[model samples]
Target: MKQPPAVKRLFGLYFHHFPFVMLTTTEAVFLHTSILIFAMFIAYGIYSYLPATIMFSISRASYYLFGESNTLGANTLQY
Candidate 1:
């Protein structure tokens, strides 16, 4: 019996990184699942933290550029 294209692709992606070795279907599935879970955790961490990091950087930059006081008059044009 032939494997489906998706299964073949998954094996190709996960197997190529290791030395040529035999793996039972269960072991392969477990390895793939572990890798996927790890990837999701990393992605979630970035998603949760990136926005706050960007906002902090922006505010810090603005404070340095605009100085401690808002001395500009209402007529002053901000670039």
Candidate 2:
């Protein structure tokens, strides 16, 4: 059975944006992982900004790139 035009379009978009989506998903996963690692390091009295800053920047960048700026209820940290 053939899919409808809308479904095809959606699939096309998914394929077109798959690279970016995958990167974003990886960044999100890494962000959480880093948070846990950083928290542990902090508990051990380690001082560093690499994990927090990198993850925060990536999230902010992704938010802007994903059209969160024009969407309702955006965090407003996009600039």
Candidate 3:
């Protein structure tokens, strides 16, 4: 048996809609970043992730500009 056309169309619209926002405040952005970093730590404990490591490296690489840390620079250089 098939659903009637009206009901099917309603379901189609409902399924395709995605309401997530693309931009947000700096604090909200950083809060999510911190949460992700914390989650990454938990994930790493379960199974190491290369992408998360690379993201951390790129973020830290900025510190090299102010001579705060060379670790990020070295990481970017290697990968």
Candidate 4:
């Protein structure tokens, strides 16, 4: 079955916005450009996740940006 063009476009938009909605950083990093790609990954993970689990990791992602080094921060963790 073919999906409608509108649905596909919506998915693309969701994926694009996924990164921004996921990464919640209070402290602005001095090196922001470097952070953008990685931030997107975090967003992807958040959106891909089931609702119940998203919050737990979302908080961790926030802390991860604050210089905490862990697998979660790296987007290496399996869902």
How do the residues 24-65 of candidate 2 rate in per-residue lDDT, one tens digit apiece? 877867866887898898876634666777777777887788
The reply for model 1, stretches above 4 Å from the true place, is 1-14, 19-21, 69-79
Off by over 4 Å in 4: 1-30, 51-79
Best by lDDT: 1
**C-alpha local distance difference test of each model:** 0.78, 0.71, 0.68, 0.69
Candidates in order, TM-scores: namely 0.65, 0.27, 0.30, 0.24
Candidate 1 lDDT (Cα, whole model)? Answer: 0.78
User: What clash pairs does model 3 have?
Assistant: none
Q: Which residue pairs collide in model 2, if any?
A: none
Q: Give the alpha carbon lDDT tens digit for every residue of 1-79 in model 3.
A: 9999999999778445623244357766686688789998998776767778777877676665656565534556443
How far in Å is the alpha carbon of 5 misplaced in model 2? 66
Ranking by TM-score: 1, 3, 2, 4
lDDT of 3: 0.68
Question: Model 1, 1-78: lDDT tens per residue?
Answer: 999999999989867876436777788778778989999999999999999899777767776898644432435767
* Model 1 pairs in collision: none
